[model samples]
Target: MLTPPEKPVHWNVDDVVVTEPDVIRRAIGAAAIGNITEWYDFGVYAYFEPTIKKVFFSGLGDTVGTVATFGLFAVAFLVRPFGGMFFGPLADRIGRNKVLAITMIMMAGGTFVIGCIPSRASIGIGAPLLLLVARLLQGFSTGGEYGNAMTFIAEYAPDRKRGFLGSWLEFGTFTGYLLGAVLVTVADAVLTEHQLLTWGWRIPFFVALPLGLVGVYLRSKLADTPAYAALEKESEKREKDKAGKDIRTLLRIWPFLLVCMGLVIVWNVTNYMLTSYMPTYVSDTVPNAQGGGVSSTTSQVLQIIVMAVALCTIPFLGRLSDRVGRKPIAWTGVGLLIVLAFPMVLLIQAGSVIGVFLGLLLMGLALICFSSTMPSTLPALFPTEVRGAGLSVSFNVAVSLFAGTTSVAVGGLVGLTGDLNWPAYYLIAAGIVGAVALWFLQEPNGRRMWGSAPAAGSQDEAREVVEHQDREAVPA
Candidate 1:
């Protein structure tokens, strides 16, 4: 029986007094846990694509089986938009915590189930079928996870530091990838290649269970953001109010959604390129004559190093965005990638250790632009009511069309054109799309969200409205 405040509460973090830095720390940490688990699972599948192809799709022959496995991987992305459509409105209606909790469970369960599945040698065609089902479940849940988590973090952030705080979410994502790389690298070291194909590949999948539980616990202990809580209070007052907005009205903001889609295209392409496909590309395509194209083990380690380098810079760019504004910092990253991605591919093709390291390092830095600012930028595109759904739909649709299929597309393009630099052309094209979209977007840095202000009340009353945020800071 909460009453609506006389006026809508401004969702700015400054309005809520924070006596402890831990409040912000805990909030950011809680939001990031799910992201870590989500990306860990994705990274495992992508980084281990070679093993996965050998294990599940062996019936198809070497090259075609690898291609088929990637196709199945892309299938998960196809389901992501549906997950967003189903879960995003529910999150906007229910609460971010509840949605996050559900998504983590689904993601963890799907990943663990993949580990438990019988190998193709034992199950015949059923192995890959079961694997595909598991992936779809994981992908579906992930659709809800990213938007809800990003919006949850952004809403909790102070205006001045939203970009910095949001950057941590991507940090979790990269850390997941890093951890996945570590697991594969360790497996490669401990197990012979046969053992790796037989059992080692499943180890990373099994890790998702415990990781997901931690994510669930972190999200469950938290209170909803003051902004979402405010929305709930108002929705209760207007009993006839619904969580699902008309699709027509949402579509009217097509330009905004398109801009988000374009940015996602840029982000996902760069992300999958450097983090997921780069290792495989370098290992498979680098010239052996020049001491290029290291073994799979070395490739995994190299990717870990590159991911580590990129991850370290994310926090800095996130903070920088807060000062210079989101657009400029984001554009700088995209611009650099567009110009350098092609050349970086050339270096990888050169087959020298120095060239490989320099190419990946440069590409990693370029990716940080989108990675650091994206959490702050995407959520700012819509007001609170439709924010979750808007981002979920737009981002997933773009990612599915571009990022999800990037590895497969690159493989095909290379086979078709016999050019190792096919990825460069793809990345550059995505960058152009991003630049065009950025032009149409207004910078939203440090701006008030939802056009909300303190309810018609005294300053003391507004302060009271946000007191729950501090109260919820008590750790579970």
Candidate 2:
């Protein structure tokens, strides 16, 4: 059995009891809603890439405009690491709840502004430039949103069910992407392609505003996590102790960060491939291949159904991880990707809707293990004080440098190699990296959180302070 703290730590703040199922559900809802808003905007943008290219970058010509449009899409990722660095510490310092509120506003505002921007014909170079600015703002907000939401929701969870609850955060992301697909697919069915290009594309972006508002209200009303409150009290008592929350201290644990980065590389690469890039890949490659061609609308609807299946399956995998542990569950997904990528890609290449659906479903199933386990797994690697900072920095850096480039990189690789299987190859390589990292990981399923103990090499005085609190406090 895993070890627990010898005694419970005392703090000035009231314990935020999360054992109640109602509290757990609320925490899950608060964390998940913001993710829905954030990814919905991204989904809308990605699904409408062709329209965006025409409306915003028409001057570049169809070929160059396509590349430039996706290039701008990728550019937003360049700023994510910086966003993580900025927001991570703020969450660690103030509290996760308030930071969530701030990120929601930023994300919703940027997305709304994108919906309002004029076309290239109306604004010349300013259209794409405005689009770029909005993307960067949304990217910045999202960089911090995932790590902090994971941290907040994880901290609120009962240790045994953390994986399941954390998975809901990812489920929110899936739902958002699904909603984006539905928005575009439905809009296409209802409006003429010309009308979609003219104004219908903006409808999904407008939805972010209200969803973000609701997320903000839900998060703002909740009490701070018990873990963060304890850290706050501890920091107030000894301002110089840098063990749990300090960046310098966090940097010293580079090994852990690398592990986190490896996992994120796998997560983001596969994630973007399925969620962001698949439609484009299908639209471009599959139609010309074996299974017969599909319309853009058919591709979008198929993806939505696949994602809906993924959404239902994720919580079960997450709950299973809670029972069996994170590593096994994570490795299961990675293993399947390595084994199934080629077959899945081949199916997708077949061009028919059934082929696309089957291919996406297989890939989506392979991705769920990584998605569900990661939210719980990443935060537990750092102490509560530095959980936000640690997970955010590592995750965003990996995402920006590697995962964000998956679509463009894979596209280029396919162009260079004349092999449509390059995306599967890319995923296989990422899965190998993740598997290696997983081999070195210590299972953290039931680890004690921050404020449960003193620093590893703390002075006698600091030890006394920690032990004193433990002895005095009454356990729940």
Candidate 3:
């Protein structure tokens, strides 16, 4: 029941109000914590790919084992769309915080359980089956977790600084990734290969429980976002007048769904490429004239360095987007992917440590462009009433079908043709799709969220916004 002033015809800025800066900080922290938990699981899995293949798919030979490992990685994505379809509308009806808390518990529980599952040697066929169940649970929960988290932060952030603030969500993303990467690297360096395959991998998975608990604690401290609070009030009135289902409303806005999916496709394609596929690609897949690709440890170290760079750069680019607008920054990412995809691939193929680092760094740079901007940009594609559902479904569906499967598709294609450049080809195709989506996107910088009143960090800023609106209302 937080309420702002009534809207004015010529100046919606009448509804502009200052949200306490501390509350906004708490909200961002709460929303971002879930991302950290979720991606931490992914980071652990990606970095442990070779060991996982040995433990779970030992019967399959090297090539098939690699594909099967990546396929399990893709399994979580397969269930994400279902999670979105179920939880998205549920969030719209109940509340974002409630849905988020539920998804978080399930996500953390799934990851923790993966650590406890017995090796294939212990359980035969049942081992991989248990892993599959855990992955499905993780995927289902993630479908709900990410989109709601994005909507939650976007709604809570002030209009003028949304881009800068929203980027913190991904900051948490790389933080989790780095944490997992560092642990795996440490474990690899210290433990023998036999010890790592037997117990070390489980260590990272067990960490998810603690991370998820922290996220839950943070989220429980905050109320649902102000935008969601207001949407609840509006929904009550709509219920009295007999409104349609959220799904039906979402269907009516199909164009936004397509655009959302397209943007997600481009962004996550690059995301999984760098974070998920690159380690395997650099260490196992790429051909080296000297013999094998870079060592497993070298690949992990290179990827960690690249992720560190991206993590540090994301906030600055996000702040920059607030000033320059999201489209230009996203377009720049798309342009880089198209123009540099092959070159980056070639650099990695060179097989030297410096060559691989530069290649990964290039991809990381392209990725942060989308990372910094999309959190703020994608949430703007739908109105508040359906925002959670719209974003969850569209984002998960796109990710499940295209982005999450990057490693699998690229790996399968490479195995089929023995081509080392398929990752580059995949990136180029994604960039082309991104360019098309960008063509249709409306710039969202400095605008209030679609169905929420303007928000400001301070009373003075609110007053300034109203005055600025008044001046604009007086005609050029």
Candidate 4:
């Protein structure tokens, strides 16, 4: 049997129901803490770039050590697909909550172990390798964190507030990154060179123990998404092997698969280019950036201010999406980034503190537009059963190619082209692609979910359940 083409549903904004504040709060918090740790974990290496180079990866001279450690830092992003694959299906098979809760432990443990790991002077090559292993673990955990949190929050959120609610995860992510930046800055002021090289580096990792614990506790208290629980509750009424009739069934819808993957590529390319690459781009171009080269203190302070500003605006942007819909917000942000790309690059490269801050504010503010909506926007393409697998597979694959590999590629580009504007051009290109993708895209803001839009709190009363009756319907 031929499967029908899925049509986009048009909505009058009035049709959407905004979720209650309490539900939104809990969902937002649940998503936030995990992300806090994820970025915080990554930033650990970035913030301590010099200390890491000096103490952790010995035997290299100044420039060589600095370059080598940053290389290793960039290397961590390359392994995200591994984490996504492991955790994505685990969420599908077991449940999103259980899988999300488990990763917190994995992340915390990896960080703590890194804190305790011996320095390179003591253990030679094994020490840096150990740090690499810890990084990979953190990378893996972080890979799973975003997808699961997105799916989880979207599932629980009311249709209208999907954008607003989704913003919380990104808010937490940046906030956490800022926290890591701040903490490392604190250690810089308080700790001596010897203490820092020997033990000060460990504080950030050690801090993860408590933060991850808090994340674990909050996740536990969260109500299993009513949607997922409703599925299990009703599964009791259905015949057996309905489990066989899972979300993997959607892969047969090739067009949907293509759209999801392509859109994710847009998100990753622009995002990683901005977040992961900018610091290095600044350090390399503006002299006095790496080690004493970049003001670790100034860079971090600027980041905190920039991200804090971004965080404050996210909810409003998200709420605005509830009124105007998602595509507009996404495209608007992308377009602004495209427009501002050149100016942002020039300002950051100017080497003046004021110019750098202004540039970052532009970049950070542009990012907020996407952060407000991407978490809510992406996962609507998949049904609940394979929400994990479908979202994980497409996103991981896109990220593996775009986000994970972006930093190094941009780094190499900067090294070769000798113009950080190469990265700016790249961002503009990505923004243009994203902006076009949004213009022609469907808006799912007020509609039912993937297979069918279920009633807000009513499973059986799902007003629409457009199953892809075709046996091969696995890609929708």
Candidate 5:
């Protein structure tokens, strides 16, 4: 006899809770503040690359000093995986907020200390050594800061709006960079060469301490996320488990780990290329028959305009991802990277103010596609139990190994080959990696985060989620 069709199973509406809008806003602010602080340091460092080389590596030739300056930048990334391995599971065990607080202090402190260190003229080799130590500390702390921030915001947001909310984390990122660019530009414009080299370059690094302090204060006011709290309670009700189990469980989800890393590589290579390396590339690395590439003031101004455009557009694209699936938007970005990488580089190579601006703008546009979507997309890859550890480990490893070293790798290659188009070639390679990874990514838009109960913004939305789930459950 034929079996009757099985009835569709219904999810309980009680599982969905109305999250307060105020709570979400607070969470977004707390999470984003750390990002602003972290990237602010990067912005200052990148924009001040020329000054930093003169300050710390003045003993070396210009090319070697440029490479060494980038080497110090890359040094911070090298230790990031270690920081992630320690903090990711710790955050999973204790709470994201506590770990984030600690990292904020370290990152801000590291940046502040760099400002205080004496230059090469004052202390000889000790200056670069101290700078290396500071960068390492910043790198270690950052390994923890960003992943947890992503988790903190992602877990707090309602499923339907996570993309829009998560985009604010990157909004903080661009704000930090823009602030750095503007400061560096203003300093370069106003200060005499001797004044800038002697005293002015240190000013932007000092700003990080205040930014970090404000971030710490904001984060301290909020509690752990509702999703993490739920998971903690569930673990308490069951037998208490060792934190090592979370790491082991993360290992079991190797496919998620691989996909997460792949996407991160694509996202961050583009990110570092635009935010960290582009300043140096435009102003220093690009060859000009007249001797210098773009003028420093002009490069900084062009970058500021690109960042301003990105900052304004990110939230809109993030909201768009919520309406359409994230994959479509990501595919557009990946496609642009693959197709336009060479053309954009050619524009920058043309050496006009407008050409450079348009080139940088194209690069910025591609970078934002991943930025707007990835914060929300990545945290969804693992179940709630391992979200912090999984996201942190995967994100940091990819960034440290591949993305974080973009400047050094690209610069070294260009120095060796004398090819200005290496940046374009690198971007194309990153885009190809993104396409492969995008193929594996499940459409995370509008779905509840893995291993978490459905969340809604209001009671009516809760009811709608249940009704929608029921409709989805019905067989065709």
Candidate 6:
């Protein structure tokens, strides 16, 4: 266990011991791997939609097959809120390490099932139904995976360097996304079209089984957060009272809740609409030509490359935030996306593969600003007691409201307007929401890790209520 600080002192990176680095490093590594596996499993559905439809929707026309497969992909995003709710307080109540392990196991199991599932030819509708179920499981697992991973890294980090440390979790997500894209590109190059749809796609899904086992093992060795440590201490002190406290206490702080919701919308819109939806947008617009100016495969390969480069740069930028502060880099990231995301789409419309690459590269860089800062900054908004629950509720509500529907909404908008750039404006609106939230958010510089507030449990907020009631009845 982490020993208490010499005083009730706030943390700073410079003060971290040589041993604490190892702890944070280990946590970051696990967090990164979880993201990598999560996206590796999720992104494949986008890149391999052609293959998946071929296997499962064989008799359907090309247009319908593509639609159904994309629909399934969208469904996974829809399940994120439930996953966040299930995993969030589970981690808060039980332990982060235990919940992390359980989540990875669930994901690995889901991926393994996806790998083993039979197609329409063999089992007909059951195949697609089962596939949707597996995707939902994966989606739900991911919901909790990210929030918890970010929370783990943020709580472990020294306050001074929190931005740098927390951003690694997002860096992990992008890295994982790139890894999935690369795997698809490489697997396509290696296998014939006949072989890939038949079996090669399964290879990627199954790969997670072993990787997830390793993730669980690594997480098993991790210690609980200092915030949780203090919560456990407080819980023990107040053993006589065992009352769950979440929504009522959270709603009392409505301003912070609104900010959190807006932030989530921005985060997910840029994430899904830009990263997940881009490949499809390119497939629809850029023709696969004789010279390969802009094909789906080529676009995916470029996306993989862009994501890889962006993921690498994210850590450096995140570390920069540690030096300068989170908001500057973060708002700049959102602002860049707001300014460039639309123009980048128009560049693609101008008809060049180079333009496509250039567009995504700019958007990816801009998206990283928010992605990197969020892991550290969002968690700092609340004290530790209800950190997991508050984040899950706000994040899920925002995502369900904005994110889960973003791809579907964008696709519908495109069909209606005959213009892909319509989605770009949507991205800008999301960024503006984030910028607004940042205006009110506090930077938790030098804040004590524990005992600052009743973030984990209700005792602190609950006691406040009792005091208020007593004062109102007696004297007011």
Q: Local distance difference test, per candidate?
A: 0.78, 0.79, 0.87, 0.70, 0.87, 0.70
Highest-scoring model, TM-score = 5
Residue 218, model 3, lDDT: 84
> Over the stretch 90-137, how does candidate 4's per-residue lDDT look in tens digits?
677666777788888888888888899998889888988988898788
Clashes of 4: 16
Among all windows of 10 consecutive residues in model 1, the one with the lowest summed lDDT is: 1-10
Stretches of candidate 6 off by over 4 Å are: 1-19, 224-242, 288-293, 445-476
lDDT of 5: 0.87
lDDT of 2 at 274: 91
Q: Candidate 3: which pairs clash? A: none
Better of 3 and 4 by TM-score: 3
Better of 3 and 4 by lDDT: 3
lDDT against true structure, model 6: 0.70
Tens-digit lDDT track of model 6 for 1-476:
11212233332323332225666788788777787778777676667767888898899876567667767777876787888877877766665666677778888888889989998899999999999999898878877877777777766666556677777887777766766677777888899987887788888787879879888878766645454465356544433343366556566666766877877788778888767677777765334211234766777877887787777888888788777777788788778867776787776665587888888887777778778777876776554566676777678778877886776677666765666577678888887888888787655433334333211113343344333433212110
Q: Which pairs of residues collide in model 6?
A: 384-455, 384-456, 385-455, 385-456, 386-455, 386-456
Structural similarity to truth (TM-score) of each candidate? 0.89, 0.88, 0.94, 0.85, 0.95, 0.85
Cand. 2 TM to true fold: 0.88
Model 1 lDDT per residue over 1-476, tens place: 11111233434435543322455677788889988998898788877887888888886875587578778878899999999988877777666677888998999899899999988998899999999999899889999999888988777676557789899999999999888888978887889888898788999999999999998887766654454456457534433475345366478777778888989998888888887677767886444324446677776777888888878989999999989998898788778778888788888777667778888888888789898998988887776667778888898889888888888888767766667778889889988988987887767665544433322123453455455433322111
Query: Candidate 3: what lDDT?
Result: 0.87
Off by over 4 Å in 5: 1-10, 224-239, 288-292, 471-476
Model 2 agreement with the true structure over 28-57: per-residue lDDT tens digits: 898899989988987887888888888998
Better of 2 and 3 by TM-score: 3
